[model samples]
Target: MSRHPDLQKFLDRYFMVFLAGYFLSLYAMAGTFSLVWSTYCRDCSREINYPLSLGVLVVTLVTAHAAVVRGRDWGVWMVAALCIGSVVFLLPTYGFRPHMGIFLSIIVVALLALLVLNSKRYRAMRVLLAEYRNKRQVERASKAQRPKVRRSR
Candidate 1:
């Protein structure tokens, strides 16, 4: 047997880690919003923004799936961009009254981003994914070039 690590297993574990971190950060954001909205924004007449939350969740999940399952680098970059965008956009929304939950979420996301960016295993998985794709392509090409053999009508 080859000594290389199993790519599927590694990806599965990585995805689990990503999910845990993502949900933790999401919980922090939700809790903070709940507390702040109740304390200060009760009279603002603003309802919870479900569309934005759903959009964020969908985008995050798709990018994570692409990165972990499809081994696409763009997915990783998208995740990073999302993280940075959240920090950039959210900080100013409070108008100099940032909550602890926002900070907590930011810190969690930052750590998650660091792990995604710095993991040697992820790098190795990318290489492996490329190699796997190349092998599949070669196999398809060779099969296409071969003459079809019909043994019996």
Candidate 2:
């Protein structure tokens, strides 16, 4: 289960991709939320910003895949933080105007669904799980190597 040292560099590459995707998703999600919020505030009806939101969500999902492939803890945390932020941002601000919150909620659902089904995340998770197991094995092995105390005569 021990990964080759050589693979660390490759892992770094995927992690970088994941971070890039994370930032991109943030920008896109914020932009889409803003766009919908702005348009609805001005027009007083649901506009067609779903496509733009979906596009950004798609990118974010793909980046989620990259993170899974790398098995990065920070990546998972980043995704979790994003989801939490979306929920926070999507909350209704005023009693009369709630379209923006609605729009954000819909996109959050879509993004969450995508994250659940993401294949890349699964692969990366596998690798990460293996790494954890390997580390555990090494710890056990080291413990076993320690000399036992002699019995008293």
The C-alpha TM-scores of every prediction are 0.59, 0.36
On the 0 to 100 scale, the lDDT of residue 54 in model 2 is 61
Q: Which predicted model would earn the best TM-score?
A: 1
Count of backbone collisions in candidate 1: 0
Error of 2 at 40 (Å): 12
lDDT for every model?
0.58, 0.56
Tens digit of per-residue lDDT, candidate 2, span 1-153: 778885686566455544444554565456546644664455654456555566766676567555645444455555655655555554544334546665655556636533643447534645665586678788999999999999998
Model 2 clash number: 1
> Which ten residues in a row are the worst by lDDT in model 2?
87-96
Task: Return the lDDT, model 1, position 2.
Answer: 48
Q: What TM-score does candidate 1 get on C-alpha atoms?
A: 0.59
lDDT of 2: 0.56
